[model samples]
Target: MSTVIAYVDGFNLYYGMRAKYGHRYYWLDLAALVRRVRPQDSLVGVRYFTAPVRGEPAAAANQSVYLDALAAHSPAEVETVLGRFAAKRLRCKTCRGPLTCACTPPVSHRTYEEKATDVAIGARLVEDSALRASDVALIVSADTDLVPAIEAAQRLDPARAIYMALPPGHMRPSRHFSTVGYFNINESALRACQLPALVKDAVSGAVYARPAKWH
Candidate 1:
């Protein structure tokens, strides 16, 4: 039996799901979603990498509940790596007037944002590869930022198999690594992995949990 390790990019996947199927679907049981793609003889374990919500109290509380649910549901199968938040410089090009508009000055500002998670994920990939943890690596992300890590892993051990999982309806090839497989969680799969609607948080009261549905 081939062993597969899955690395999920939480933010990338969240936006992808939102882009494909409107706003209602947000809460997702990642472990359950991955199981839908598992082959009978494959699928050893899944590693989910995500950063916690930093500012908003309500949002943070809700996220805590969802994370708790994931842990409670699949204690053995799922492992989560928490990431940090960072400030990034944003360049905004403003447009003036209408169709025959002139380009305004580019504004640069720093905003506190979710930190790059690919670094942690990349480190884990290399670590696992060095230890010969699994037969294949399944990375659930479309961010090309992970190209170096993927290439390094292949260079280290030429036999390690690397695959990609694009979010539903979004497909793109990586600049560095050629994707072997592209797994998209469609509506049917989402339906199979959807979490319960009502979630209780320690800090907040009952919050509405909307799991991503298949579209």
Candidate 2:
């Protein structure tokens, strides 16, 4: 039996689900979702990597509840990686006209926040490889930032199998990175893992309808 381990890019998958099914489907059981994809006699463990909510007290509390539920269902199966939000500055080309226009910092700087998840993911991959814990690795992310880490893993174990699970709406692989094979999680899979109505948000009383089809 081949030992399989799954590595999920938290923000990539979360936004992907939101984009495909809207915020209503936010309550997802990731381990259950992956089990649907596992082949018999091949799965050994599943790993999920994601950062916690940065702001918004209500949203954070909701996320914490969901995380607890996930852990309760699969105590040893799920592994979470924490990432921090960092702010970045961007300059608008239109704001500064052509060469004649003087460029001055806007009265209010534009701040964009993003989660730092790549480094932590790469480190974990290396750690797993060192322990020889798995025979095959399944990476669920579309970010090319992981190219180097993937390559390193292959170098460490030439026969190691590597696969990718691209988020919905992704049609092409990154030019900088490619995988031996890829799987796209479509609407059907998303719907299959949709949370039930009872545990749905109690505040807004929102409930998600399952997708009509299954993948």
Tell me how many clashing residue pairs each candidate has: 1, 0
Off by over 4 Å in 1: 88-110, 197-215
Model 1: colliding residue pairs:
187-214
Tell me the lDDT of candidate 1: 0.72
In order, what lDDT does every prediction score? 0.72, 0.69
* TM-scores of all candidate predictions against the true structure: 0.77, 0.77
lDDT of 2 by residue, 64-92 (tens): 76665555555577776667766555555
Model 2 alpha-carbon drift over 4 Å, by segment = 88-112, 195-215
Model 2, position 84, has a per-residue lDDT of 70
Highest lDDT scorer? 1
Per-residue lDDT tens digits for candidate 1, residues 145-182, read 88888877777767878888787666665655564556
